[model samples]
Target: MKVTNVHTRRIHQPKEKVSKLFKTLATTNDLIWPYENWPAIKFLEGLNVGSKGGHGSIRYTIIEFNEDDYIKFQFSRPEGFMGTHEFKIEALNENQTEIRHEINIQTTFETSLLWIFVIRWLHDALIEDAFNKVENYFTEAKKKATYNFWVKLLREIYKRKPLQTKIA
Candidate 1:
């Protein structure tokens, strides 16, 4: 099955400032990923091409990285996820910017079932939470994204399992 997914948000801040926050992705000082509410993205060799890491049971390797533009990761785990997912910073204006997360992949039957039944809902919630984290950074009033019923149920079920904390 071929899948194409995208999530984007416009921030009322300059691209430069938003890009600075993106630079902290997967880092100790990460300012974008909603690690407090979800699994944190980790890279053994940091944010550069060839670095390997991922959140939860999914895994990937960085295929491209541009400090002020975007970072793309090619999936290598959760068998049958063939392709890439990336986060891009687009300047909409001198004082506004858009943060986009896109996924393009072809999944095998098993993975397709997983994606449709579980991953899709979880992925949507995760991305929205990440966007909220970014938007929360530049405003006095913070934004929070709520998970849907399916997402809440999925999270509850997944919480019963032990989480992986280190990347190998």
Candidate 2:
């Protein structure tokens, strides 16, 4: 099975301001990873091609890096996940920019089942929080992520599990 998802966020900030973020995009991008109370994404090495990193139970290696524009990571986890995911920045106008995060993967039957029943649910919530974080970056009033009932319940459940056992 092939699974592809693209999630985006448009910021009021200009591309130049957003581009400045690319340099630290893979390393300390706390703006997108829900670092305060959630699992934070981190690269074990430089945020460039060949760097290794992961968050929670996920593992990936940077495969492509285009400074100020794009970065791609090859996933190597979830038992049968095979593919790449990327983050891209596009200038929409003189004072606006957009952030796009996409995942493209080929999965085995078992993995497809996991995606349908488990991963998909968490992935959506994760991305939504990421979008909200970006919005909060520019606004004076803080923005909070609102998860659905299931998302809330599942996250609580995940929090109770052993750190080494869950992909959350």
Q: Which number leads on TM-score?
A: 1
44-147 per-residue lDDT for model 2 (tens digits):
67676888777777778899988789889999886799999988999999988999989999999999997887778788888777767777877898777777
Give TM per candidate.
0.97, 0.89
Q: What is the lDDT of residue 17 in candidate 2?
A: 80
lDDT (Cα atoms) of all candidates against the true structure: 0.93, 0.79
TM accuracy, model 1: 0.97
**Pairing residues by index, what is the TM-score of model 2?**
0.89
lDDT, model 1, position 12: 93
Q: Which candidate is the best by lDDT?
A: 1
Residue pairs with colliding backbones in model 2 are: none
Residue 161 CA displacement from its true place in model 2, Å: 1.0
Summarize candidate 1's per-residue lDDT along 1-168 as a digit string, tens digits: 999999999999999999999999999999999999898899999998999999988899999999999999999888899999999999999999999999999999999999999999999999999999999989899887777799999999989974665676
Worst 10 residues of 1 by lDDT: 159-168
Off by over 4 Å in 2: 26-29, 165-168
